[model samples]
Target chain A: MTSRAHIAEVFMRGLYPVLIIASFWMLLRGHNAPGGGFIAGLMAVAASSAYALIFNSSKASKKMPLLPARLSVSGVLVALASGLPAVFQGLPYLSHPWWTLSLGGFKLSLSTVMLFDLGVYLAVWGAIGGICLHLIETIEENL
Target chain B: MILPVAPLLVPLGTSLLCTLTSNSVQLQRKISLLGSLLLLGTAIVLGVQVADHQSISLASGSWPLPFGIEVVVDRLGALLVFVAALMVLICTLWQMGDVDPAHSSFFYPLLHGLVAGSCAAFIAADLFNLYVWFEVALICSLGLLAQGGTLKHLDATLKYFALNLVGTLLLLTAVALLYGATGHLNFNALAMSVQYVNPAIMQAVTGLLILAFLVKAAAFPFFAWLPASYHTLPAPSLALFSALLSKIGICALIRTLSSIFHPSPEPLLSMLGIIAVLSMIVGVLGAAYHWDLRRILAFHSISQVGYMLLAMALSTRAGDAAAIFFALHHSLVKAGLFLCAAMIFKLSGHYDLRKVGGLYAEKPGLAAIFLLLALSLVGIPPFSGFWGKYLIVRECLVQGEYLWAFLALLVGALTFYSMMKIWLEAFWKPHPSAGWQAAKIVKPIPVTTGLCLLSVIILAIGLFPEPLIGFVNDAANHLRGHAP
Candidate 1:
């Protein structure tokens, strides 16, 4: 199931880089803005799905950096662990504890809530991507 | 403070852990069992705490009520959670022997996921959060249902998934409409705001909500999916599904009816009453016709749900108490019966009574336990089911709902007939085939011990029901928006 359209492959190659950067932008700005983990995760899924479509799903899956199941599991663990400090502090579960750091005169704010969001990001990306890949493979096999 | 969220945290954390260690079958089982025990412990402690405190509510992220998700553990919620946790532990023990090791990696995590979702559903104080939990439970159950990946499993899962997705959509629509109408989604907030909403609109929203919940609860008109899909799975999964899944729907119905729409419109109440009677009759008739053990039990689950809905229809404190008591009793008796049925399947290699027999002669202990559980389910005296049914009948009679009371009694007798059919065919009749002789007993000890433990609990509750009755009364009072 190799790509037969060179234009389609070229288009995907150009689109994916932009999509990945947009997804990161969405994730980083999600906390107080309109975009969030879910939308950003969808963005990432879109990029990969497009790439798979042009390059053939089997080859893309072979070259994938991480197995979707492992990614999703780790994501869930990270999300769950993000809540532990609150329990230790005698607060309600999932209560966020925030911190601010200045590195090289650049200020950054971090919190358990961000970690939770990041976890959701990874989870959604992996879950939907895995499902898409599976469906594509099944379709290919049937064809 | 910690108690309010312990039930949720234990299961969620365990599920994630299980998922992480899915490669190791032994480790997955150990973690899952340990997590279930911890969940049970937390549930018991939470129940006691709620009993003493009247009700416990916690808002996640310290967000104030009406703005953030709330988890409230009142007497009834705590009781249901505790029972669910117990069932989870027992089912996990049964799973040790029942589940194929190849499937354990998926089974353990999904089981814990289901537990977490059910616990969340029981305690959720917001309409949207309840929907979320319902979906969570549905997703996990769907995964578990499809774990075998056989043609039959896939078929059942597809049907179950499709119907449940429709129900979920309906529920979400109702939640959206309610939020639009009342501008509040939290149970407490809705209770206060609902009174001000226009009556016609409120009724419309209530109808939508009831329809969604009834579908989930497997009431008469929408119950076809239950019997079709439930009997297709393994016995341990069936046991869990029987014990907790539909009951969550019942819990949601009771909570919604009592908290948000108490003194439910008389017409709606009567409508529900008629539906309840139809469910009872249809469910029992279906059970009587089916010869398969699990199918008969599945049909009975529908009929038993009818009894609870009947109590809900009464809309009185006594009715509420009876409903709660009946729900608790039904979960225990039904789970025990399903586990027994599992053992029978193992011993006889057939769920069909026509092909299986002589259980009494082969395993008299199992036969006796099944008899006791069946009798309890039939509402025999000195069994826990009797008190629940008696209370409902009494409440109906006192409320002058004689027709409902009579129908409930009639259903009880039919339930008896169906249970007797199983007893007569499987236990009393001669063995139909040599399969019983060749059937291997797998992990008989854990399975038997779990069944016996549940049976003892049933008998203990039967013998001394005053404490539970008192608890239900308190729960009823709370549901009535009164201080206990």
Candidate 2:
């Protein structure tokens, strides 16, 4: 590898973490604002994938907490499970009733809809990231 | 009744769980099997409930009817869902057999995904939701078609993809146009508000939608993808594709035409009739030309779909009833015949009918099961196809469509000839390779089990078709609104 490419990789290695943190911020703030799971997930994917452009699939994949396929499927489970409470409550599925926890250390406002959004976040991150990384790796192999 | 969405959710949930458990093939397979069984259980319950009640619907997020994610299960939808779940379960069992290919590890997800999508398409109460479900099914089917990992499979996948992508695009455009013209995407809302919309816009937009569905249905001129791609799948996956995929499009057409586009669109009427007839004749003729087993069956799928489309296009109570019966009968019989073809290939070591023979002398039981399935495909007496064709022809005659009636009968004869072609070449003639007594080599227990199960279901439906007939008639009556 050239020195210029090496320098690019080092730059991306630090930038990737920042992008992921920004993605989470996007995901969390998604409920009240315009930003949501899909855009945040895309941002996260863009982060890992930029590094992958300079490196290999394995190294970039390791940056993910869960592998792409697992992340996507686990997201599905979470999303579907979020709807389960409504079934038990005899409400429509995905009713997303708010659950508030005002405790000493934590002031949390959670709902199944939030869980669903988080699931969507993880799912989008995994599926798109997987596709992008695979394509990039294919290009690298051919080169 | 409260859980109208259960039928849709079960298979999708199963598919996800299977994907999540992909680390252990055995565990994944077992989970898949359990999931399909649960799906079938849910479908059976839903079917019975819908049979009792005329219809059941649910809107997610506790939203009002028109603006929510909605699922509705009428008798027809419930029946199709039951059949889809059954096919998935059978295919799951068949895949567990020793006949599976090396790369079949992906089969679980694809099968459940396809089933889930079909179920969702059947029950989706809104146009955009239906499109989303159809895409899910389409993507999963393409995955199955391409999983063979060969150049030929890639070629087939591209063909299927290209055609389906156009259909999907057209569908999206139509939906967007309709929603923009009238601010409703729900079927009931659209149906109510469509009359107030401009006739020109309705005609053009609904025309596009019907044409899009026709492509998805593999109606004439859009059917090339089916024969090209379906031949690449293994038997289990092929059976599910043959059984459920096109039927969803037919059902969608029936739903939209009968409900939303009541009285039918002006110019599209005769055009749909001509397309149906062409599909019938062209499909059987293509089947006549193919010696490969899957290609022949693939072509026949187009023909059978034609029958259902014709009946549905009639837009009468009896016609809808006949269409529903035809869809149900054809799903069972076609899947049975495809499974039997797989067994023949297992016993004879070839899919080409020209190269294989002597099954009648060696394995009479196999020959007999094939005969029942083939005969059903041919619309013979004492089988479900017989009634399916009879109702279609009778409905055509009643509609003063003499030419369509005659052509349907002609296609039946042609279908018979194709079945005979398979029978003579694969079952009757002497084995091309002498001293190759291949009958005793392998029994294919799993395949024969599937074949027998399908045949018995066909036989039971054939013998006791009164219940199905009544149910479909009721479904048709319900679709026709309060005047039944």
**C-alpha RMSD by candidate, in order:** 2.8, 2.2
Write the residue-wise lDDT of candidate 2 on A10-51 in tens digits. 888788888999999998887468449888889888987887
Candidate 2: C-alpha RMSD to true structure equals: 2.2
- Give me the runs in candidate 1 sitting further than 4 Å from their true place: A1-26, A31-35, A50-65, A102-106, A136-143, B98-104, B433-438
Best by lDDT: 2
How accurate locally is residue B418 in candidate 2, as Cα lDDT from 0 to 100? 95
Q: Candidate 1 chain A vs. true chain A: TM-score?
A: 0.83
Index of the highest-TM-score prediction: 2
The ten-residue window of minimal lDDT in model 1 chain A covers A57-66
Candidate 2 structure quality by residue, lDDT tens digits, B1-484 = 2478887778888888888777788987788889888888888888788788888888988998788978899988988998998898788778777554325666788788999899999999999999999999999999999899999999999999999999999999999999999999999999899999999989999999999999999999899889999888888888899999899899999898887878777478778888899999999999999999999999999998888888877778899889989998889988888888877887778999989999898789979988998898888989988999999999999989999999999999999999999999998999888887664434367666777889899999889989889999898988878532
Query: TM-score of predicted model 1?
Result: 0.93
Residue pairs clashing in model 2 are none
After the best TM-score superposition of candidate 1, give how far the Cα of residue B233 lies from its true spot, in angstroms: 1.0
**For candidate 1, lDDT tens digit of each residue in B217-294?**
999888988998988878778888888898889999999888778657778888899889999999999999998888
TM-score of chain B of 2: 0.97
